[model samples]
Target: MVGYFGANLDGAKPLNYDDYLKVPQLINLQECKSTPAHHDEMLFIIIHQTYELWFRLILHECDSAVEAMAKDNVVLAEKQLGRVVEIKRILVQQIHILETMLPSDFLAFRDHLKPASGFQSAQFREVEIVCGLKDERILTAFDDQPEALARLKKRLSSTTLADSFYNLLSRNNFNVSPPPERSQTELWQSWQEKTAKELVRLYLAPSEYYEFYRLAERLIEIDEYTNLWRYHHVRMVERMIGSKIGTGGSDGVAYLQRTLGYKFFPELWLIRSYLT
Candidate 1:
């Protein structure tokens, strides 16, 4: 028997904040590979661990948004997506915290991270997959880890946030369906154009289609913040390592630069050009 806050609960253990959040175990997880543990290594580990937590939450919210949209609940879907947008803002800011570390400080422990890099974050990849960036090449990186590969495969085959939003538009009588039997990039561009044509109407008369319009705008914000995060991350990496190859053997800054233009909701962005 123990007291929880004030009331007594018989035959039950009281829950403390530390116990509930597993603070002890969580704090212990930042094991630095550097012998003697470089002073900046703790900062490096904690920042990335925090990112994984945020990525998990982002996935949770995105999945909820998808479910909400599937049921034609645009308001709830938008609400969930709004959380993702704000979290992405935090993600952009969070990466900059690494910038405070001197290049010399990071180099003290850099070599210890060979073959392991942010590029290998499976949860982040799942976030990309859930948000509609399905590239099979990413899967090859996880061949040695079956659990992550399985999750990525599930996310790849599942309905993405973009798929849900476009389906919602279709239910509202928009022409989002693809031209039959088209293949490859041509088919992809055609689908984007067709969806963009209808999406433009939402922008033209936002108040008339408030639900769809609001949700679409939220998706755009999410996409925008996603790009912003990528841009900032690239800048941070460039600052920390210059032209050096990544610990994960990636091209580092150059590879990150290539990811800048990715959009989770391309049609929503395409509508902007057609606005006038």
Candidate 2:
């Protein structure tokens, strides 16, 4: 009964893999139309869907970290971020899985799909916004989903991961800022601005907080890996689909190109500039 999963103590079945799979709705693969039978259609579905499921997990870990950071719960936030880094490794591995599909194989089923591009993936977009990719133009895709749109708008507008990093730097007594800017840059610029700000702050502060400064640098390393993963995805997709528009209506190659330029934690890299 539904009660079994609903925390009902009575008539509860012991849980194991076999027992769990016996349930009526434990991820039954629905039969959807597969075009031209790419001969590797199952593999294709598995890869993309698995990536999505992984994205969901990524969001779970990253969002928890963001929420923790907001409370200045540094220890808890680090744990959450550690989970995110673990998940990022998994996400990175999937790129290789997708590479298994040759260009010809992808093209066969490509026409079967409409313009339902990854650009329209609200979840991925949220992850970007969380990582400081705050371009207002990217928000138009979710106009139909008012709640999701609203949430992205809020995340874009508020203190993002970059803001949290800045606060972290401030906690350590760094007080840097960039040359006055009239507008905000999304992910890439977000990191740059943060870096630029922190570099100055750390230098200006009267000699102390070295330990806190190290923590900021470590997080920047994590963001660097994340940026690499995102760029790798863009390249992989570009290899498979070329500049042709995504089935999701996004400008395929151009979109990927644009995304490559984003850096989620600018301050880390900016400090590197000051290192020399």
Where is model 2 poorest over a 10-residue stretch in terms of lDDT?
A: 176-185
Writing each residue's lDDT as its tens digit, candidate 2 over 110-138 gives 77666556667777777777766667877
Using all chains and alpha carbons, the TM-scores for the candidates as numbered come to 0.95, 0.76
Query: How many residue-pair clashes does candidate 1 contain?
Result: 0
Per-residue CA lDDT of model 1 for 7-113, tens digit only, reads 44775656768999999999899999999989999999999999999999999999999999999999999999999999999999998789999998998899998
- The candidate 1 region of ten consecutive residues with least summed lDDT is 176-185
TM-score between model 1 and native: 0.95
Backbone clashes in model 1, listed as residue pairs: none
Scored by lDDT, the top model is 1
Cα displacement (angstroms), candidate 1, residue 270, comes to 1.3
Instruction: State model 2's lDDT.
Output: 0.66
Per-residue lDDT value at 155 in model 1: 90
In model 2, the runs with Cα more than 4 Å from the true position are 1-12, 18-26, 29-31, 35-38, 176-197, 200-214
